[model samples]
Target: MSTTPPRLTTASGIPVADHQNSLSAGRRGPLLLQDFHLIEKLQHFNRERIPERVVHAKGSGAYGSFTVTHDITRYTSAKLFAQVGQATETFVRFSTVGGERGSADTERDPRGFALRFYTEDGNWDLVGNNTPMFFIKDPIKFPDFVHTQKRDPQTNLKSAQMMWDFWSHAPESLHQVTMLFSDRGTPDGYRHMDGFGSHTYSLINAAGERVWVKWHLKTQQGIKNLMADEAARLAGTDPDHAQRDLFEAIARGDFPRWNVYIQVMTEAQADTWEQRTGWNPFDLTKVWPHADCPRIPVGVVTLNRNPDNYHAEVEQAAFSPANLVPGMGYSPDKMLQGRLFAYHDAQLYRVGTNHQHLPVNRARCPFHHQQRDGAMAIANGGAAPNYETVNAAGTAPSGFGHGDPGWALHGVAGRYDERGESDDFTQAGNLFRLMPPDAQDRLTTNIAHAMQHVSDDVQQLQIGHFTKADPAYGAAVRRKLADLREG
Candidate 1:
């Protein structure tokens, strides 16, 4: 017998009939509700579109595996990294922030680097961005900052004035703003870019010792980016260029890879490292200089398989910082703390409440839960207890309780929004100074072109931040903008 799946059928398992035509009173007359097939098609079509993500809506994803090549059990005892030569299946979604699903691939926006690892224990989602820092360190300002990047309320169009207005007022945004308006901003495609977990997270070892860590996925493909003109040309001609590039690469067996590395700081080192470096270690708006904390090589992640279906795998794929397996823990960083909640809540709204059950997001390891029924409940916990009790004998020792490791904590809880104490300008200045002269010129030119549409006052205010980063940096941008205005 030829073993094959049956022919195409309706969603309710009924074979479709005359799919090309709609049931009507007569030809081109009012449709009849009794035609269940037509009614089902229209209803499903109407509800097909779920809400697009507020950020990182324009994205591409792939299936891959991460092989642990180094011993990192001293830093984190997470099962995926427990031993050298161990491999874990992973799903990665690369996205452009501040754009709709139909937006251009080459737009100068931060590329989101979200990774979901299907380890032996469970799933661990490390959702991050291309840059090592963010525009705002506090979650309270996130919504406001995103609003500036989004469409203007009245015009329903992107306004440079809105973007610069927020960045100019927020001096702490300088580091990320500088990075965003540079040559690296317009990466050639997803393959030629680096990925970073922007926030500092804690990792606990088998000994129960905790340390702060930062993840870096340096592209093995090496860095390649499009010039502004070329980016604009491609944006118009081939909006799905990056998506096509990644998909075609894996299809032809030319797999893309990234070298995963992590920088670790002990709890004792975290206490006074800021005093030594003249910067806060936990600040999401800044990066720890590699000289201060060098990255230790961990593993190599390669995307060897292209996803079978885009909508079923990529679009439904959800990632959250809260999805941590054992041997991983949280940190006191306010941004990290906020994301621990924000990411989960965002997924709940964007994907359904049972998003965790989706294949891409679901854990490969056996998992049981009291999380019963709701919309899209693939597994309804049939005949199982829905509540936790001693007699119920819940999912073993875990029992819906998280023993997420322990750390030393002693602090007075209060509103700590004051950013003046943190030195934000020095690092940005250092980055600018470190750039080659040609890179510097490109950076300034990029900034000027992007800022040309904004008001002069907004331009001047943003220039002040550039000026604060480096006198030469600010002067170059000013001159470039002047030349543009004259033309």
Candidate 2:
């Protein structure tokens, strides 16, 4: 029997005989830069890390499939929802929004629930959170809000003062702040909580009719949370508790799953929803009540496979709301629009110019584009034609639609003040009232304890916003704090 000799080659395809020894002036002399192999290896290692995410720095992911359980093909022409039993490959990542890679898994913070669907059309990424609503609606306030959640520059520590200061100034945060302080903020693990597509998106049917929509993923394991005290204890005992829970549970053949559902609104209804609710339909800080827009079950997503390499499959796995399929489109939600640009730009910086070429982020379907070559080019597009004729038909289906519907815009381009124009308090106030009595009590007590270290000036200012949301809300929180001071 004959076998081919083992081959060794450099990145440029040059055959190499010795990779261990580098060329030097002598056996004991200084090495030479002309040693292309050594220089290349060292240079690549020097640039190994791009940059950790400004948010969602720590995360875990799993391989899964989405099986459509119910179909509403009339609502969306998206291939993923085209049939009642269609199954699509998926990847879901759960993360702590403000924590570093080594932060405690039990941190009382909103969790990131990012889903990537490898549909026949392309990858449709529904990058969302475990909560249905967010802290702020406007994209401009995001950087400032996150800054307060992160460590203080001077002290290099997480500062309650910074967090409270920002919340007091931004009244829109009351709803999310209330949610964060409650039991739900400290989720038991990644498997026991629901997820939300927080931003409103558009669905275009085959006929080109557009409707606003939101997605939800209800966990099959049922909702479970750690109380404030339990969370604190777990934080000290096991920082990787959630990560281990997900991996171990999957390894035991007990796959975690979620029931996918969507709430949709017709264009005509969207026109009047703002007036009806006193909140913008596209606002990220609010949610369309299920009573008004009942959830229509669409599918079930089951995570059956755990990642073999966390760094390659999870750390470098990029998901973006901008990754929309043909029949799906974007709404005018400012935060979602800002993210469409930010997420891809962030991936390019954090991973590489050709980050999409990675096996995890790459498209499943044969995708053709003019993009090619960068720091890690896959052979620089080989000998393919770099230029094509001016026309290759339209980018959309035959006579269906080309892009997102062109809605009319008439506002003057200026920094328009939204204080009087927008109703930020009503929704948050209603959320407080809707909570059960016991939950409301826990929420206030949690706030009081967390604010014990906060300054009076900031505390007073913050409570004032809660007061506007509900007098009872403000009074309960104030009473708790007063007792703490007296004791």
Candidate 3:
């Protein structure tokens, strides 16, 4: 066969004879108006960039394989975990949840560990944070919570007062606040920390049994966190340390991996819990107690290849808890329900409405949906009718298939307030009590360092919350902070 190259083509694959010479009057004159190909190329290039994510703005991604090492079919009907040794293609992105696009990776904040597993059945995304719980449980309070974490517009600086004010008023945030002030707040890097599906999910088995579940992706490298001083130093010296570390690790063939495990609870068991007795399981702020349902290891995920293009692969990647396959499903978790709408809404704003068409996020298997005609829509329904159950050609019939386990809802139609619960500080106190002396010392020092920057009233308010969690723990932090104030 001849070894010559094929004809050049436009992005749409239309053959182009001479791209070197623009359509012109006489060979050296002004360009003609008939340069459609040139115009299309330049226009597309000019609009290639979309807005970055508001949160998790700065991130890095890699391609990976998820291999099932243990059978979990009893828990989920998802084919990806149906059999031992089964493998699925996955794309994972690691990010800092609160910081801007240029924020330091080692900052004392939660990390986002979002993974998309493209299986034969469909796409399943586990969008979570390194910490198991959050600062607030109610979806209505989410925007307020985030606003506090962001910078103060008047000062154009991050406001610790804003953060503490929000946390102090929302007593339920104590558990997560305690975790955030601990060493775990400043993880050594993305690879050395554990990730948790903070929101509870529901998994249905082949037998149609439903169980509430929480996913944990334990870093195989083991948990490592930086001391407050060390983290501050690194943040100043190497702001992109975590992002660079992940990129360098994959490039050097030193792949990073995590062991996937899950803690599951039954509906009957959930009926007794104070929070879930009448609450939704999808709430993102509360975490299921591990003692009630211990974690069971299910599989291993190894990220082996870095994205060749950061903007194309990593920046364009979109993940949402709503991207569930057949076997895995959602719960009434209010926060989760809010995210179901929020994540996709954010994606539409940041990456255009047709972001799913991006190669990094497209399903591996063929996909069919009623979605049609949006900007950046690369794969137009392609001759297929956009409506279902239509007499038009290429229209497929629409009907409901399998649904979640049948459960009766006997509540009224009007909005109601959540029932009062006992102290939210108990679990946080337990976490503090469990920490070793050295870790506790580090936690106190870190809290003091952060609190010292805020007003004395805000500091007092935060210490009051801490004291409620554990007297001794609060006393230590107070003592350390008072010493700092005096000195």
Candidate 4:
């Protein structure tokens, strides 16, 4: 092998004559158009950035492996979980939901926990958040809800009034509103918080029997959170605190791990679960009671390697709930159903149509598709037929299999309002009542601090929802708001 340094060259492999200076007609005159290398460099730099994610704009990611610790074949036939001690290559990205790409890592927002498992069957993407529940249950309310979290269109600033007003009107948001005001909203960093497949999903066994399941990842490092004041201080002092912590910890070989568990409910149980608990089992805003459906250990996820290039690996890595292996399937969760379409569409627009050809997203197992050319078609099906008709043999691809088992659906096909259909406050009240006295104090105090700048009418309306959840809960918030206003 040659020991000499490699020569610098243009993208087309022509040796670069001079990289430091642009080719010019004279020493200080106009730059020459014939300078192909200079033009190439400038053009690439101009398009260097793809559009940032509308949500989860700021994030940190690492390559990891998930080792199956227990047998779950009785529940799912996914090859990655086929046997005990099986390990699957994985990539995990942790992110803050509402912040911009340059926003502070310590912002009081729900953290995104998106995991991708490269199984022999295909890539299984489990996209979720640190919390088990979300602000809304349906997709139609999603854009409006996100609008509240974002800047006010007229003022170009985040408005507390907007958030409060929206939440007051959408009483369903009370559950996640309670959570957001709690310490969990301001996690210490990426390594210390739990992750959940907040949406309910389905698991199909070899026998083709289906069961509803929710995924959970409990951090092995244990839960740690920052106080509101401390989080604010760090946001100003070190905006990239969480990103830095994750990279440094992995660099120093102190890899973070999470024990993966899933709560399973049978089709029979799912049918009556809502009727019994007064909570829709498929509601994204609700959580399955642990007492009713216990967490069963499945595996351990250990993130051991940090990405070498943030943009290439971390930023470009796209995950969708739609990317599921054979055993895994979707549920009737409205938020999840909406995400199934939105996530892939976002990637197609942001990352180009051939994003799956990108190294970070490419499937490990052999994949054959009739999908033809699009922008940046890196690996167009070379020489092979792009249509199924050319096969003549009429045999489908190896990995291709029958679709998921279907379930009965009975509902009027109309825009039915869910606000009055479900008992939203009971669960929110339960969560508030579950907190200890000090935690309850902190929760109310946090809510009051956030509501300080909101309109009185909006505040009163929100307080009423809280009161319905638990009278003491609303009373404490009302008192705290009063104290804040007076002082």
Candidate 5:
């Protein structure tokens, strides 16, 4: 048996004699133009990095398995949840939203919890966030909201004034704004925070009965958060603290897990609940209280394997809400409807036209499609017909069944404002009141600290929204702002 390592070769399989040096006139003269190896190396290196995600740029991903723990077939006939012990291969990406690729992990920002389950049917991506609610209910305001979270145009720095100014104008942002300032905003790490499919989705049963659902991944590690001071210190000292923690934990066999739960609501129940509470079930800014729609245990997701190549497995990985299998479907959530198009389009631009052909994003199950001939087309349908056709017998081939259970749409096709139509302040107030006195104090203090750089008008306007939520909540924030400013 040969016990020698193989000789290095160029990309074209040509043996390489000198890899450390380029072909030069002498020792350090001008390089020869015939040095294809040198040119290949430099060119590949220059184009190695793809465009970073517009949001959720800094992320860590891992492979794992999702084991069904309880029966939910009555709600959805998704093959992944067919039995109590079924285990489906999974990959999860934890990210910091609104941060650049090199941003600190401990920044006070909403975390992205995007999960992909490779089931027998296909890959199902549950693209979500650590928080159950978002800052805006409508997708039209999303770009505007995200712009505020990013660098200011003139100064090229994050501006609290811009954030507060936007929030003050959009009362729908109150609930998420409140959550962002709370300790939950700066979670200890990815393992200690909960993940929620913030948009209301739908689950269709074998009987074709559809139900509105909200997905939740409750961390088994329990919720642990960092105070603002500690978070800031860690951000400066160890910018990759969370990424290191996750990688090290999995390496040492201390795998992290989250118990999956889903809150179900029937169509009739959704209508009645919306009328009773004066809240739209499809509103991205609100949450369906557990009291009204109880959570049902479904499965357990454990991240036991870290990616071998960060760029190949993690960076190129793309998850879209549009990736749905049978028994799962979409809803009327405006934000979700917008994402259905935006997510895939972004990946098409960022990861290339055939991003799905990448190993990390590929479905485990066998799939056949007429789509072919794109850049980096790994399979390219392998000589299969690229278009559907009817045979000489005048019969079409069997195709994938429709997964989405259609719903009725009854509304004027025009821009309808939802400002005074929804009760955004009540939920924000309810969340504030739910916290203990100490937690409430910390929340108020955090809000005050974040608002320090904002203008007085924005602060007062935001305080008024808080007042509408709860008098004490508003009063506490106002008092803390005064004390912090005075000090």
Candidate 6:
């Protein structure tokens, strides 16, 4: 017998011919169900689309590797960094946070910078955003906060009225709101923007020592942003500009990279700072100033390969804050806690109950768990029962080992709402003051242009909030928008 491969066929191995054309009456008449080929093609085509992600809906991703350049063994005992010069295969997705699955890639919104590292121990996913802080710290308001960013239910159109109304009442949003209206909001593309964990995470060592840390992935390409005019034109001319840029760059061997850094604060330092300065270390809406705690470079992540199949690799990729490897752990940040639950739940809804079985989200190394059966469970679970605690089967160390390292907890638990000592306006003011004069002019003008679309009352209210951030900020915005007539 010849060594040639089996004959090519359709998914059911029913052998296909003339795939380029559908079965029709004289190649133009209505097709018949007897044409199995045509029926099969149409059936698959109808089911090609799946439910889109609820957030970070519009995105682009690539496959890559993260090589550890520096040893951070003192900070974490995770096996991924146990040896020097260790490299972990990674998948990273960059996305626009507030838009729908079909929204323009160039929208002036925060981008999701989520990374999944297939380490020897387990899959470690760091899901974050382009900006270092967020609009709210409390988890209770998160749903409403996101709703305001989304389309109004009745009109099904993005509403500035809803966004401004909610944000005006919650002054904590002033910091992020200011950043969103600035030129940096419309980044040139995914490659040129910075990424941050936003919330503080904990790191524990082999010796059980723990420290609070915030992860920052500074773009090696440097920060580049688009002006309102350039972004608007590109959105219409090439809505997929960022996605195409990433794919073409990687194909041309021009890999994009980012230098990963961590701002570490020791437990002693946290206690001392809290006692002396009264600042909560776990506040999600504020940043730990570089002056207070400097960034220590950890490693570099370079994306050198684009996904072969976008839907299988990129769209189905699932990431969550709960996918913690040893040495890395969670914090008490309420928003982070909420996301720990929300992200996985969303993945289940969007990608199926056994979404982790997909190649993009699957662990590279062997993983044995009693997770058993769910819809679309493709992996072989063997003859073992899905439930745990079987005396006969016997458990032998599996599933990321065990729970995270312990940390002391205090204070009486009750219905208590506490505030961090840091002011929202200080950082926002700092950001505004750092911009070059022309950039400041552009930011003011951009805010004026967007505010003109909103009602005058809302515009005045937002201007007042900007005034609270800084007198110059408020005055500049007001000066630019004065030409708009109030009816």
Which of the two candidates, 1 or 4, achieves a greater TM-score against the reference?
Answer: 4
User: Residues 295-353, candidate 5, lDDT per residue (tens digit)?
Assistant: 99999999999999999999999999999988999999999999999999999999998
Candidate 4 off by > 4 Å: 1-5, 390-403
Return whichever of 1 and 2 wins on TM-score.
1
Runs off by more than 4 Å, candidate 2: 1-45, 391-404
Off by over 4 Å in 3: 1-49, 275-283, 390-403, 413-422
lDDT of prediction 4 = 0.93
**Model 1, range 344-433, lDDT digits (tens) per residue?**
888889889999998888899999899988899997789988987776655555312344455556778787765667777887888898
Candidate 6, residues 1-487, lDDT tens digits: the string is 8999877678888788776776677766887667888787779999888788878888899989998888898988988887768889999999998888878889999889999999988999999999999999888898898898898999999888888788867777888877887888999889999999889998878776778999999998889998888899999999888898888989999899999999999888887775654456787877888998999988899999999999999889999999998888888888899999999999998898889999899999899887757888888598877776658867665323443446678889886655444566676777888888888788888778777677777878788878877889999999888865443
lDDT of 2: 0.88
Clashing pairs in 1: none
Give per-candidate clash totals: 0, 0, 2, 0, 0, 0
TM-score of 1: 0.95
For candidate 2, the TM-score is: 0.91
State which candidate, 1 or 4, has the greater lDDT: 4
lDDT of 2 at 128: 98
Better of 2 and 5 by lDDT: 5
lDDT of 2 by residue, 445-486 (tens): 999988989999999998888898899999999999999999
* Candidate 4 local lDDT, residue 238: 99
lDDT for position 372 in model 1: 84
What's each prediction's TM-score?
A: 0.95, 0.91, 0.88, 0.96, 0.96, 0.90
- The TM-score, computed over Cα atoms with residue i paired to residue i, of candidate 6 is 0.90
Note the residue pairs that clash in candidate 2.
Answer: none
Candidates' C-alpha lDDT? 0.88, 0.88, 0.84, 0.93, 0.92, 0.85
